[model samples]
Structure formats: structure tokens, C-alpha cells
Target: MNNPVISVQNVDAHYGERQVLFDVNLDVMPGEIVVIMGGSGSGKSTLLKHLLGLQVPTSGSILVHGKSLHDVSKKELKQLRKKMGVAFQGGALLSSLTVAENVSLPLEYNTDLDQNTIDIMVRLKLELMNLGGFGHLMPAELSGGMLKRAGLARAVIMDPNVLFFDEPSAGLDPVTSVELDELILKLRDAMNITMVIVTHELDSAFKIADRIMVLLDGKVVQVGTVEEIKRSDDERIQNLINRRPRSNQLHGDAYLQRLVNGEGEK
Candidate 1:
């Protein structure tokens, strides 16, 4: 593949003393959906924070467009971040703002566009998210699934080159989750945007990911296409994919140490 839009190399992250990501290396090719998945305490959230520049890795580095985020000037970092979008889990909408206003906030703050133009642009995005005519509704008025779509609309409102989604399928009914997955696929197809998704829904991961990275206890165990992962012989990979319980012996004192370090055992 061409040089990745996002490159993570030998990244080790820590919460105080407890390392959460151990020498994790991955790449996100443009226009591909790469899902980072694992159970709780797997460190997927930490990886996402690393990507978003919210947390610094204890070692190694993350590079976007060949520029390392480690120690970059704040001005440069802000500009780099402008090219990305994030749809956080739980909608993350402001309780005080209407959907149109929430989506318009980015353009209003980031651009020189007039109110009329911003309004038009926000409406266009809401329409693209299949949320047409619902722009005036408050987040509280929408269903769980509609809320997700609204969040997506806001994320892509700026036409970012890279989009990151956190647990897009979480807490929704199966049908709603499936609908969100389809919307994810459609976004990639229509916009050709690079997508990094963090989710544990096996069916959603299988359906939408071009590649999947499975992390376990702060370490990356496997990274492959859906078929490759499904056929993986790694016992942990099998346990995860098959929805089998982790062996208690496997979750021993090492796990406890990791938990004690900072990431408490779940």
C-alpha cells in the first residue's frame, strides 16, 4: 500500500506506571476501515487517545502524514488535527445545543464562513447522514441510533480526510448497530476517507473492517483481514472471535500487576 496516512510504530503507552500498549505497531491506509478491537482492559481506548494526541506514548511515536506527533509544535499539531474527525462513543452531543448548531460549531469556529453558508453546509451534512430535516432537534429528542448518525454528521461536517469512530455499535439494538455499520461502509465508499474504528462487536467488525487489529492486555496479538483473523490459530484470538471466556490461569498475577500499575483489572 502507499505510505499510510497514520503510522503507529512500536508504541508503548502507560497510565502512570502501568503500560497499556506494548510495542504496538499498525498502519491505516487511505480509504480503508481498520478496526482496533479487544475486550475491556485491552488498551484500544488508549491507542485511540494516542492517535488523537490526547495521551503521549511512553515510548515510540505516532506519525500522521509522515510527521511525528511527539514534540511537534502546538500550532503544527492543531493544523494536523484539522484533517481528522472523531465520532466519539455515546453521541457526545452537547445537551444544550440543537443538532444543527452542534454540527455547525466546527465550521463556525474553524472557518470564515458566514452564518448562512454554515447553516447550508450543516444541513447538507445532516442530509448526507440520513438525518435530513432533523437538524433542529435536540440530541435528547433522537433515538440512540439517530444520535450516532448525528455525531457522524458532525464529525464529517468539515470534510476531514481521516475519520475515527469509537464503539459505534455499542448500546444499540442489533438492527440499529447493523444500520450504523452500513452507514460506515457507505461513508468510506462515497467519501474515500480513511477510517479508524474502535469496536468489539464481532459481527460489525467482520462486516465493515478492511483489516482488524486485535489487542489483548496491552499487546497486539494479530492484525489481518477478516478471513485471516477468523482462521487465526492464536488461542487468544480464537477465544475472542468465538466469544469464549479467557482462561483464569491466563488472567493471573501478571494481569494483577498490570491492573495495579494503573489500569485496574476489570
Candidate 2:
């Protein structure tokens, strides 16, 4: 197997005094689609932030293309980040810009290409994303599915080697969600891009992932192929897959202490 394109080792993350990720570790190989999945507050988004160098891990390290994000100089980090692209959950387009302008922003900021050349390139990407003729429309005019595709088009404008997608199927109709899934698979196949997708959608994960890493309460419950995950007998994994709520029996003293002190109790 090829070396992992992205690696996370013993990562621990915290927000203020609250710990969100605990000794989390994973690797993403070149051209592989690895899905990080869990329900709300599972630390999926935190892990994504770490991977993108948006936030440093409280402890541990994240390596992108064999370079430690924490150890790299700012210029080096910026260069390294050029190899990565992120499609945020909300599409994250500039409401003020037209669709074509939004998609071309990365090139405008990062490159000195002439207007004609940039326009040509942007059109090609938009066409690939099925938004070729809609470039004149503003973000407010696009449907949910179109917005997602537009965000995706912008994410790939730099031809990044790694793509980080957050909730790709979120906030869309079932048919549109399926279309987005197909588009994601197609993007992987056509571009050979390594993907780390953060999603709580089980069906979407199963459909698009080469492997799935299940996170529960800031820890990895399991990392396996789709079939292996489906066959696992872990109670937590089963509960998540079956959409059953975890039953927690509260210890009165601990609950009372936490409530009074504003701290967590295990």
C-alpha cells in the first residue's frame, strides 16, 4: 500500500476546559475515501479542524503529506495547505459574489493567471460540477444541491491532492443527497483525490467510504471496511447503526457535583 497522504497520531483536542477528542488517531492513504462518522458532538468537526490546520491539537500531531502542521513555518504551512481543499457544510460561498466569481476566488487570491485564463478554468470546473450555465446566478438563487456543487467546484479549483468534505449530503432532499453522493464518488474516481469526509449520515458513509472510522465521545470506537463495520458486535457501534439512543444511568453525587461546579463527570 502507498504511504498515507494524511496522518493523525495520538491527537487530543480541547475547547476551553472541555476535552473533545481523546487520543484520536487515523491515517488516510492516497486516493482513498475515509469517512469519519459519529452523531452530534462526537468530535468529528474538531478532528476536521485539526486536519485542516485550523486549530492545533491540544496534544499529539497531525501530518499532512509527511509534514507536521505544528512544526512547519507559516509560509511552508500555507504552501502545504494549497494541496488541501475543504467544502464546508453551508456551501460557504460569498453572497456578494456571483457563482463564477465565488468559484474563481481561490485562483484570484493564489495565482497571477490572466482574467481570460482564469475564466476559462473556472468554467471548466463549473461544467464538471454541473453548474456551467448557472455562473451568473448569485448564491441566494441556487437550490441547496446547487450550492453544494458550487462549493465543491470551488474546493477543487486548485486541483488539491486531498479534499476535506463536511456533511456533503446535509440539508438536501433524499434524491439530491444521492446525487451528491454520486458526484463525490465520481470526483474521487476522476481526480484520484484522497478524501476525509466528516458525516453522521450512515447511508452516505456506507455508499462513499473506502473505510469508515466511527467516533464516539471523542474516541475511536472502530475503524474498518464497510462490511467489517456492519459485522461488528460492539454495543456502541450497534446502537449508532441501529439509531438507538445510549442509555446513561446517572450517579446522583457526580451529577450533582457537575451541575453545581459546571464541570463534566464521567
Most TM-score-accurate candidate: 2
lDDT of 2: 0.94
For every candidate in turn, the CA RMSD to the true structure comes to 3.7, 2.3
lDDT of 1 by residue, 104-177 (tens): 98898889998999999999899988999999899999999999999999999889989999999999999999
Worst 10 residues of 2 by lDDT: 257-266
Cα lDDT listed for each candidate: 0.92, 0.94
Per-residue alpha-carbon lDDT of candidate 2 for residues 226-264, written as tens digits (9 for 90 to 100) = 998999999999989999988776799978887999875
Backbone collision count in every prediction?
Answer: 0, 0
Clashes of 2: 0
* Model 1 misplacement above 4 A: 248-266
